[model samples]
Target chain A: MLRIENLNVSIDSKEILKNFNLSVDEGEVHVIMGPNGVGKSTLSKVLIGDKNYKVNNGNIYYYDENIKDLTIDERSRKGIFIAYQHPQEIEGVNNIDFLKTALMARLDKPINLYEFAKSIEKLSNDLKLKENMLYRNINAGFSGGEKKKNEILQMRLLKPNLVILDEIDSGLDVDSLKIVCENTLEYLKENPKTSVVIITHYPRILEYIKPDYVHIMKNGKIVETGDYSLSLKIEKEGFENIGTNIIEDNK
Target chain B: MNIINIVNNKISNSKINNKIKLKENKNICIDIIDNTKLYIEIDGINIKSNIDINIDENVNSRIFVFSNSIDSKININVNQNKNSNLILNSFYKNDDVKENTIINLNGYNSNIEYNYSCIGKTNKSLRINHYFSKTNSIVKNRSVSNNDEIEFEIIEYVPKGSIDCNLSQSSKIINLKENKCKIKPILLIDEKEVNASHSSVISPINDSDLLYLMSRGIDEHNSINLLVNGFLVNNLNLNEEEKHILFEKYIFRR
Candidate 1:
């Protein structure tokens, strides 16, 4: 459902992603594994049209529509959602209120308040988030795990067609990770046509949610694509050993 | 709650359980006692007024002051007696407004919490003095300026003998336009035993915050409106009705 061809991204006139390319089909799960500063998070942000990231070359196609010129909100309304690694803490905006506004904006219609409230209650319970958190400010004073869960909560509420989980496994405890993974799996089961792109450094989360293809990203481009065994090999031998031959071959 | 309308020099005889409406040019003094809640509405054209409020000993009171005026100058003074408690919430939206407010902790063990929110061209100065031991004061101010300039100067003072007093001041201004907005928080503490802190910030609405909001499918205009409303209306001790009225009259009017 999403395709990127020879994408070159930069920030502050310094290139970060060089000739990056990837494609994800509908109902497929793609996991990108890489070391720190390999443009994993940058790719996530660029996909959502982050203003700081300048697209120096190439284009992004979502269902064959060029989205390079679309604003962040436009892309979001077109069913692209990114769960930030570090979710922002908005001090005054209520969590539920923000979700409601976002849901309304995405659907471009009025919502039933009773059904909205009921859905929020059910989702919060499923995520193990406290009911009172809905009444509090968006991610303000929340624990790291709570913030991650909150992002997942918004993902469920918005129900985007393309989901980019940027380090969703970071800062989560064992139980919280299990809950998040289970909820994600449930979402995939319910919506068989939604596509997901999981970005991470380790294979800990892969144990819960298997990927259709695991791609090793190095220097802002995919160096190797393999099955789930590739993640296990990296875990055992490390990223340095797995992608050395590819880099030497390119050199 | 009684609704008392004050216009010109007319003063309501009812002191407690009242929502007082002040209009036009007027000077009024009120003494609150026996645990009460007061909602003071200030509205007029070119209003100039002085308001004085005194809280009696051991009394706990809450006051909400909402003002929607133009070209106004208002001065409010408050005094708290022994072991009294007071919570004051003030909101102002005016074209050109100047306000000076002073509060005194006159008796031991008294405490006060002051919250202020405003919009438009305003120059507001506030001072709270701890004249007795074991007193406490907390002041928080939030303002938004679109085109016109806004400035807030808040001061907290404690004398040498006012031991064990606590004081804090926080002021922030969200400048929506390329206009000059300033926040000054000053703490004058002569007592070594007192706890005092102050902080101030003035800037445009955060771009990252806006991006985060807009990434959730909210348009730029609606996202900004939501943030502005949250900054001004949230955390205030206002009922739903009062918040709705403020949003419709002042926030949405922009």
Candidate 2:
């Protein structure tokens, strides 16, 4: 489980997340829905400890241990994975090498190359990715949808205890969305303890994964926390009406 | 055979003129000492020599001198003796040493490969020029210079109608201090039928590649050494013994 209390984050002296708080329990899928530039992605980057995002004030706890002093790689090793909305394209480093290196870093040992390839191949087939992609550079020249699938591949291979997916549905076609959602579902089914924090704007992906809890964020803070019907209500009424409700409630 | 000589201004200098008409296979080792001017001419156009040298071939091989003394000059004439293969190795270490090297290839099917390594400090400048005229010939050259307060310059010219030959040139400089080092590699291609390619990359070590490796728990120096080794390994064609010797001499510096 992961917990955040009054998490304050800023980039270049501009505050983005103002006293944000959230808690994710094991085996529960939490979907964070918000409009553009409302700190949905900032929350994920803050959790992943991106150097650009400065933590001005707050505390983040992963499994009841304070991880404020841990490095980004250390946090990753401690079962925190972030499937980037735009995965980095690393040139001259092959996909297989990158994956194996990541996996070895997680396990802290030299993994068997043959078994690694076999396991990745099985995952690739499940995710409907071409096996030949492993020979190319990591994410280089990949289409937008292909890049999203590659992120899922890493998530599957690493299999962290808590996976934070930031906007995985944006650029995916219907078929790709289906495959990505199905693979995620299958992963959660296999590993029952793995928790997920899905950040998205559209409710299409929720149609497949069926999030256990949904939270609506606006202007750097979560204004509503409810069951899946909140997402359905927002989809029907839209953010314009939702904005009016937020102002009236405050008044 | 004709001999060409030019002496614009005299510093401390030396002269060498040799002609071998029938020496088919020759092993020649020429050493340019510090603060000494040198000149040599090759005659008969049929003698083949394997030359090994030490200087900074990256920048102006004319003005820069790597020596303890103030002045040095060198003049070289290389004539082909029946399509020869000339292998040259040069090294430069000081900023006060100034030297000049001029080689002329006038035989068909001849090949010249020159490799140089230079470490400069306290104002080093170098100048080098080579001319090639023949058919079915090749030239492979590379240089490495590292340090601060070193100004290095190199200019190479290849004329027209030299068919069926290729030239490859590269220069790498590692600046460990606040020294000025410049690498100018020039190639003139007048014949459209010939093939020539040149690449020059002068950059400091990449921090991202280092951090990426270090994030995986690799030692800092080991990651740097790995990247530097990868850069230099492409420059040398090393036999087992030469590779081991270079590993100890340049990399480990023992």
Candidate 3:
């Protein structure tokens, strides 16, 4: 479980996340949908301990332990995973080398290269990725959808307890979206104790992975909370049309 | 040629210029043509041999210089004939040294490949000059410095009529500690159609690289080791034993 209580975050002295709170329990999927520039990506970046974002106040807890001062690697080792919306392109670093290092970092034993290659081959085949991608540099010259699939591949290899996916469905065509969603949902089902926070703009992915709770965020705050129907309403109308509905429901 | 073991050497103040000629294609050791040039020292030897090499037309040769001396001062002069190829590969771990090498490509379409790698905290001054005596000649060099105080001055001179020649230099300096490393590649080309390029980089292991490596559970120290190894040992055509020797000597010893 991960908890964020009244987290006030700012970047470059400009306020971003103000009085924000969210809790992800075991065996649950939470989706946050909002308009652009509403701190959806900021939440994910802060959780991953990106130094560009400064914490003005508040705390974050991972499994009841305060992770406010933990480094990004420490947070990663603690099983808090974030699939970046825009994954980093690191040249001259081989893909298999990176994955093996990550797996080694998470596990106490040395990962067998044969087994690792087999798993990567299976994942590559299932995602329909290029066969040579494993030997290529990380995300170097990959298409946007290919980069997204690479992120999902990392998620599967890392197998963290709590996963935060930021806009995983963006840049994905229809077929790639289905492959990504199915792979993610299958992983989530196999590991029912894992929790996830999916931050996205489109509701297309929600059609596959049902959310236990849907939150509408605007101006650095969640304005509405309901079942997946909130996302459906927002899809039918727009963000502006849901404000009156939130007021009506709250009253 | 077999490279000998290292010995604690002393500096010597003697100079010997030995001339060698190649009419037919052959591989030759440095001491075979110029074995009488000896610098006297107590514990170990200091090599101060000046070599002048002249190659005939269509001759191909390779020269290997493996120095285990702790102090050395060497100078080399080269003249190549038409369609000839010269390969010079030198590996050294010296204490302090001043070395100069000059090549004159006097024949059309001649080629030279000069590879060098050095280890130790020595003060090194190296100057390499390539003079294009004819059209369509080429000279290329690759060198790596292992945290030494080295000032390299490389110059490629092409005359106004020397056309279609190629000159390139690639040098890398891996610094684990703060050190003085300077590289100046001066291309003095009078020809309009000649190809000349130079690239030199002096950087420690990049922080982003370290972070990316450490993100995979390689701690900072081990990450640095991996990156330094990748930078220094990769891209070379060394055998496994040579690579192990290089890893144990230049990269890991520092």
- The top-ranked prediction according to lDDT is 1
lDDT of 1 by residue, A1-251 (tens): 89898899999887888988888999999999999988989999999999889999989999999999899999999999999899999988888889999999999999999999999999999999999899888999999999999998999999999999999999899999999999998888888899999999989999999999998888888888888999999999888866655531111
Name the weakest run of 10 consecutive residues (lDDT summed) in model 3 chain A. Answer: A242-251
TM-score of each candidate's B chain against the true B chain: 0.90, 0.54, 0.67
For model 2, the stretches where C-alpha displacement exceeds 4 angstroms are: A243-251, B1-254
Worst 10 residues of 1 chain B by lDDT: B16-25
Give me the runs in candidate 3 sitting further than 4 Å from their true place. Answer: A241-251, B1-106, B110-130, B133-152, B167-181, B197-211, B233-254
Judged by lDDT against the true structure, how good is candidate 1? Answer: 0.87
Which ranges of candidate 1 are over 4 A from the true structure? A244-251, B2-26, B188-193, B235-250
RMSD of candidates 1 onward, in order: 3.2, 11.5, 7.1
The 0-to-1 C-alpha lDDT of every candidate, in the order given, reads 0.87, 0.61, 0.69
Q: Which rank order by DockQ, best down to worst?
A: 1, 3, 2
Interface RMSD of each: 0.6, 4.6, 2.7
DockQ of each: 0.72, 0.07, 0.23
**Candidate 3 residue pairs that clash:** none
Give the clashing residue pairs of candidate 1, or none.
none
Model with the higher lDDT, candidate 1 or 2: 1
